[model samples]
Target: MDGVDKERVQKIVYEMSKGSKYFENEKRKEATINQKIEDLRAQCVLLTDEQISFYQTVADKRIIDLEASRDLSKTWLHSDMDAFYAAVETLENPSLKGKPLAVGSMSMLCTANYEARKFGVRAAMPGFIARKLCPDLIVVPPNFQKYTYYSELTRKVFSNYDADFIATSLDEAYVNITDICNDKSVSSEQIASELRNTIYEQTGLTCSVGVAPNRLLAKVCSDINKPNGQFILPNDYKAIMTFISSLPIRKVGGIGKVTEHLLRDVLGINTCEQMLQKSAYLCALFSEHSTDFFLSIGLGLGGTDTPQHKLRKSMSCERTFSATEDESALFQKLADIAEALSNDMHEEGLCGRTLTLKLKTSSFEVRTRATSLQTYIHSKEDILAHASKLLKAELPLSLRLMGLRMSQFYDVKPGRHDPMQKTLKNFIIKDASQSTSCSSYSSDQHLRNGANIDPSAAEESCLSKFESGHLMAVCEPEDYQQSNQIAPVKVCRPGNDASGIKDNADECVPQVHADNEGRSNPEESLTNQNGKMLWWIDDYICSVCGAELPQCFIEERQEHSDYHLAEMLQKEESLNNRRGLLQRERPVVSLVGKISPVGDVARKKQKTSKGKFIPIDAFFNRYKKD
Candidate 1:
């Protein structure tokens, strides 16, 4: 049944897939891949022997460079749960064990057990197509909560071997166990054996473990033993290289179905050894990066370090629904997505400056629109505002899926030596009355230094604002519910400045104002209470640009400042046009007394033209030259 039943499975799959939307889409992709292969073959045929030889020289050099960079001192392990989701499902209900089971709906299969795989039923195939292959295939709807619980248990086991194990997904991880093997004076095989046994003992789940000098070979080795087994490749270079030589290129991580077909069909590179032999043709056919990647695979080299501390690039939430053409319903869905994204951001203590709207049309076409803001935002109101704007811009969109993502994070929490706190302490001490204790003053204390401190009065005012929907809670309720946790929100009286309070000290306290019609105007309320034109200098503010910020957790302020500087240059260009001076012809003047191509003349104008326009880059670039 190794290869004999494959054709029967294929015929059944083709019959089940024929005329279906998924099949049609797959056919279109296959056609595109076939055309690419044909093009590559044509390109190879057109190349002269001299040109082929030149590419071969370049590829050989690349291979030498890659092989030189390989490190055999490290022990890398790849551990993956055996049919993870299916295993978890069967574990929960032992009756489903040894049965051909698949997890996910009829629309798609998430994962299938080895029992199902015997019938050629696989992950990512539509459940109906899988059913056609194996009529007895049991389809179970995915339970992410249950899966997450078991995944955490497995990760707990992984943490014992390597604290910084890189979890690629819920079921798989790449762990660097170099220190463990060295410190414990044990072989990689022994370590992997203990890991597998511990996981099975703890969670009643079996996992495959592969140990090699690098992640690439380790991952390939893991798959060799299939379910509930372990494989180890020695650190010897000859053994590692020999193992890779016979292995199919398709078995490598980065080589997908399309790349596999192209290599096999066009270059006739079925194995890693064939890839090295055909490297010259691949180098000529593919980009430099692609060529390097193929050669690295042939040399059996891959990333050994697990980047555990890498900050998440973005946080997002999305859901799929039945296709809908109703504009109002779409807007409602957008709002829901915004709310979910806000909750996720709050839970993670993250706020993002960029809001991205992702929409999948009923026809399966995906459209994404992203907008960057002057400030970091994590509130539902703020997210909804930007998301709605993007959504409306692409009006009358019929969609099946909607998503909201936030990126460019900033931490809003205050540091130990927060500048805002220092400023507040200075102001409080300067204005303190004789009876006031400036150093020990609690947030609940009323200001005796010309300011009224009425806790009851302030609480009433805050409650009124909350009831009117003008005041929004800054922190999640669960945060305060934890024992020994400090409350993140504080109430302050309206028309009374509470700049000294920890919660409001560095935050942009929106001043709600009543208009002539008694309606609250949020736009006018953005200004300071004294009616002065000033920037929102909250914790998320851009220090250089004076622009209000969204999230400030991550180190993106420098990048955002550069963005502001770029905008200032564009403004300067526009100003130069209005003044009838060509931008390039006009000599750049220094705002500060710094290095200047035109000498001291640029610095002299700084005093006289104090209110005039001064671009940030022009000022900084002069100093940079100096």
Candidate 2:
């Protein structure tokens, strides 16, 4: 024992003996003295401080020891079971012992035991790759609900000793066990050992206990030992420095691969010691925030105060795409992502207003765009469509990665009068109608899905409809420009149904217009023998209203087809020059809910008398009924 601790023990004993209680109640007084002596003797035996200077190594050491021993005096404790998931799986199926095991879902591995580390298997690695690495590796699916049940049971057991301790996650917690052991006489290590035994007796899993000056050191020390092991670290500078120097720079939390490479490979730094030495340069390289953290870490200075913060405002998950380019493939991938994200949001009972699309180019350049609507979004298609609009506005760049993040969280009160429900309901209804329409579309008509609508034909359709003064352009010039530029498969609601009748329809029926891109196609041009441009706008749109629309509207295009730019232009030019094809009488053709050839129905009907023929009035009556 150090002289100072020895002297303190002597003083306590001497004072207890001098008390009049010794004479009045000799038994009680002697008991008190004996207890004090034992307490001091135990601590002294453990090697009390040899140095007493403030901020000195010995001072820190003694204080840390005091905290540890004091915590031990309490009845409660906290410990984390190492590799709990993999270990439990291996233990229950004894035949799998000593083999690598991981727990996760279809896409990514969640946890892997030490055995898996040998083969470079790790958490977050693709499950297929993990299996490839260790052909016989046991892959266990995560049973989070079951794990949570057991975790609650464990917490209840710990509560019997002290109510203060809490399990932070499924894996860990902190306990304040002050009231149970009451004596304040025994060392904390002895208490820790007893707690360990009690835990093992109740649970098959083993844990490592770290008794230290505070949570920081305690947590760090706990990891020093493996399963079923326990360790402690004195708060002394020398001991802490020795411990830190042995760890890799990356071992310090927040030092990721990029930062590791920046420090180790780029800056020629390999160890914590080297990082500590180049503090100024490192700070300049990273920024003020990172430099301060690393410096504190190097100095063995950790948080002593409790954490205080509000609940998380949002939850998000994202991934980097494995392939770049191929816009169709990118769009499909994004659609899948939208579906997955919407599903997750549904699971969490949340609907967001803001939809953010993040894209990382092949050069690692990141671009993000977000749009906040007045309504909430829940369906995958709606989310993907909005994100697609934004993507189209962005210049086409080879994509290294893309992520869809939904935020602007508004609470979802399932039973309340949610204002966001109106839009979401409309989206659902529209999606359902689109499904039905797509199913009934003729094979030839289906081919037009994702087909580029010709600008001139769209303009002709719009101009002709407006000339009749019944069609109203609901889309602004900007939206028309965007839809036309990207050759989007569908446009938003046209303020009326396909029959041009305005009604309070909740569903937004998309308008399929002529592909404007066909006019710009290399094979099709309005120019004569000379290269002089004949058309101011290669694609036609309503010159007055500018609603670049098709002569006949049809929506629901199949995925994977690039814009049929060539065919759409020929169709547009034919419609614009319809005046050249003389006709005796104009047939009032109601091109709604029926498939008809491009001005070939009359010829076909004449060629075959058996062909079914119907008066134009019948078609108009059918349209009115619909």
Candidate 3:
């Protein structure tokens, strides 16, 4: 049992955890796993010789592919702080150094120091159970702020060696030292030693470092020499293959407890060598991704390169509380969580379309409900609206934990131009020009005289309208400004009659309008009542609403028109339903089809009620007369 006193530890753990909710949950999980193992064995028994041969052929091909992709030139170093959180707490209070210590509360243990681990107490095990095993265990509440400070100190040393190091966690990092090894005329082992020394000198903390040809081997080697030690695997292929062959599959990252059981119990594959021997069975049992991973491990191949830049895939905020069934209290908690999530998104300049609500019932069951929006949302109001809907759907739920997660992130980077922006700009410009040509001089005069516009005011107004209309697909604000100048101009279509403006010739600037009007005044508009030039082009108007939109680009004007059209459709649908008339279902339909059975019924009902139902106004008049 890897030097652990398994029987004694198990007895203590069982005695402490018996009859507890957590223990019961573990029992249920164990039973589920046993059932799955039995099912896997049955499937194996039913497999034929032909199927096994086919699977072997597939595994052989996959191994060949993985071998072809292997790179052994670069040197990678994986560094992990020894009992990070526990060490930090000890450093702050030196009196607790030799004593057994664990970080976290009685419910859960985050990390345990070497002294505590001697009694088989480890991270993630409940503190109460740990106490039963090691009676002298000193449970210290975690101090994240202290840990972060020391983590930063260690990272500073890492930056000196590899500027683009990957910090996998608060206390662990993967650094590529290939360039440094070459530059300093030293080996990877020497570099790792110096790094460890530097970290100890700076933070007064002990750490373990491992140097290998790739990150996977480096990480594995880092744990071989426990706390305050360094290990180096030679860059030779033979050395790596020898080391990986005897290594347990469980020791490899990504192969968790369930996978370990599958390899050992089902396939009788415990070590990497066994994995290679039973590769055929694995290919048949697992998916392509898992098969590839197992073969890569067996071949001692791992990622040799770390990504230069990392983009966040998802962001979440979660909290645990006493189990409660109060609906009002739960909603209040959710509202606070939504607000926190919104603040984080806004601070990071992130907007996501998908929102997920995660809850852990008092019985330790986890449930998640996700909903996606057509547009990205960042505000607290939008987050709360979606979260409330999801929460209400699962109402009367007694929860011990609640969390909000947002994913499918939008690229909210400012000043980044989209490829579709130019095409959308051209479409809007063409439509706006067409709409302006149809307008008469009376309307143009009305805009010039009555509409009060200022350059900055118009710009702000257009921006607000663009955002409200969800025109992100068209163009960003920076792109819009760059494509179109924020200046007022009158668009005159070619070949239009200029009779109305002919008398005021001197006041107008002669300009040629494309397509419909050849001769017209490009500038004959009056200033606002405040004497500020209204920064509006006479050509930019919403065709649907016939409302003048003071936008600098065509895309903005078109988006404004689309927003109005959507509003009008919703209003029309409501009005038709009130009047007992079936709404036209052409423009608005479910994803499946435009004409559904429900729509057919509504239409039939409308036809039958046409002559029987009185008009809304007539019905009201009849009631008044009575």
Candidate 4:
């Protein structure tokens, strides 16, 4: 798109894809976007002078609040590999250099080389369609293993700059070089140049680097001078504002084609500056979440901190969203994460002496602080007490994510390998984990079905045939939190609105009537249930997992309990497998050596002789001597 004839390529793409399903789907999506834009436009017309004034006031107030939280101390660099997959392919096959090349099959293309891109045969285009755009284009199958090898090579270079750099993908990463710049007394430009040169030297793959005060602008800057180039936006308010004033809205990361159409067609917002000029319209037409991001973009603001943690043999829970410096909100989120972590630890009968608190700044600088206590703790109250102290020490810090990791197990003695090894193998907690490193990381769940909300979305019916079961703590019958009042349970039916299977809901628990045409949104059902939903849940929590499950659903709770037990058993079995392998060689080295199964080993080793049963090893040694 940068240099190619856009109209010609559009015609070629259309000719090649006109009748295809992909084309039709794209058309459908375009129509939907257009319809949504029209709806927004209509709403805009309906807004009176007073309404516009009110929205503008709200927007201005939010802008002031958001600006107060900005941190310009960190210099964020977004390093992007130039045509990563294609470049890797070319590096491996020198003959492919200077030729139009693509890394993918006829079905889809991951990326295209610079030469291919000039012909408008770009990434995400179908390979067959790309061929039409540029008949000379050479398509190749992707080799991820080779790509990963080179990616690691580049990340090794990255570790030198910032060991905690966040690798968003194999070819791109956001690194906060604030400390290095201060320590080395160097400019941000020099660091970006060094990184680019070092990566080129090591892997024969050139990269583009963008240096700015925050991640968003850095990312935009990286794309400006593409193909083995670098761009640095000055870390000054005037410079940042000037740079983004006329920048295209489409250049922003989260603004896709649909959003591009919406803004340009509806609000006449073609640039970041225009977005600010029309903030009132944005606030009026879109959700607060969407408007907040738009306002931030207009002001040249973005997340400077997001926590990237390295979870070891520990239990942790965290969430990521828009960054904020709110004290009460931070404490509340911290408490929630801690509570979830507590439940996970208790499920596995674990307690730790050390608690690590993780905080990522809006600029993505991770600050981890820790506290060690003499006594091990697993309860939510104790975890929160220690973690809150650690968080308080880092007060007035703007954070996008917070996590609590409980480590340094109480049962793990320093010198004891067996217990530690067993614990490592057996107690691999499946709790939510989050981490950040200088290199790329892999993989980043809960099932609460049967939500009680939205009467229109649900169909209610009575389960007259249903027979009630004694269901207090049905998840694990022995694990009940004893109380005089029996709390109700919730039964969840998958692929439907969580059809409440609550037994004795003061009546028959409502069954969501099966609607053949009704669409189900599982994600919507899983969102934070509001205050209204908690009216009947009372003070009760699920006995088995210690999570709040509200009023009961017995059959589903049993399923959850079964799943929990099965997971525990699987971990125990894995530990046994490891110990079994270790024990196999132990008896050969010394008969007196410890065996894993004492009773079974005794049965196998003991044998009756003439009078008394002699030790097996001693008896065998005497025969060999004879």
Candidate 4, residues 18-137, lDDT tens digits: the string is 876446767776787889988888999999999999999999998898888777888999999999999999999999999999999886899999899899988889888899889999
lDDT of 2 by residue, 581-607 (tens): 212223212222122211232222222
Task: Give, for candidate 2, the lowest lDDT window spanning 10 residues.
Answer: 554-563
Each prediction's Cα lDDT score?
A: 0.66, 0.49, 0.66, 0.64
- The sequence of per-residue lDDT tens digits that candidate 1 reaches over residues 1-626 is 24337988889988876886556667777888889888989999999999999999999899889888989999999999999999999999999988999999897999999899999989999898899888999999999999999999999988988877888999999888999999999999999999999999999999999999999899999998878898999999999878988999889999988888989999889998787898999899999999999989888888876653455679999988998989989989988999989877655545567899998877666789999875556779889989999999997877899999999663212222322221112222222221111211231234324344343343343233333332222221244446544333321211121233322222432334444456533321221112221222344453333555554223243234323322333243334345554433433221111111111222222323212233332322222232
- Give candidate 4's error at residue 589 in angstroms: 45
**In candidate 3, what residue range of length 10 has the lowest lDDT sum?**
588-597
For candidate 1, the TM-score is: 0.65
Give me the runs in candidate 2 sitting further than 4 Å from their true place: 1-78, 105-108, 118-120, 126-133, 154-169, 174-188, 265-276, 317-353, 358-368, 372-385, 391-403, 410-626
Candidate achieving higher TM-score, 1 or 2: 1
Q: How does residue 324 of candidate 2 score in lDDT? A: 67
Residue pair clashes in candidate 3? 493-516, 493-517, 494-516, 494-517, 494-518, 495-517, 495-518
Off by over 4 Å in 1: 1-4, 393-397, 411-626
The candidate 4 region of ten consecutive residues with least summed lDDT is: 436-445
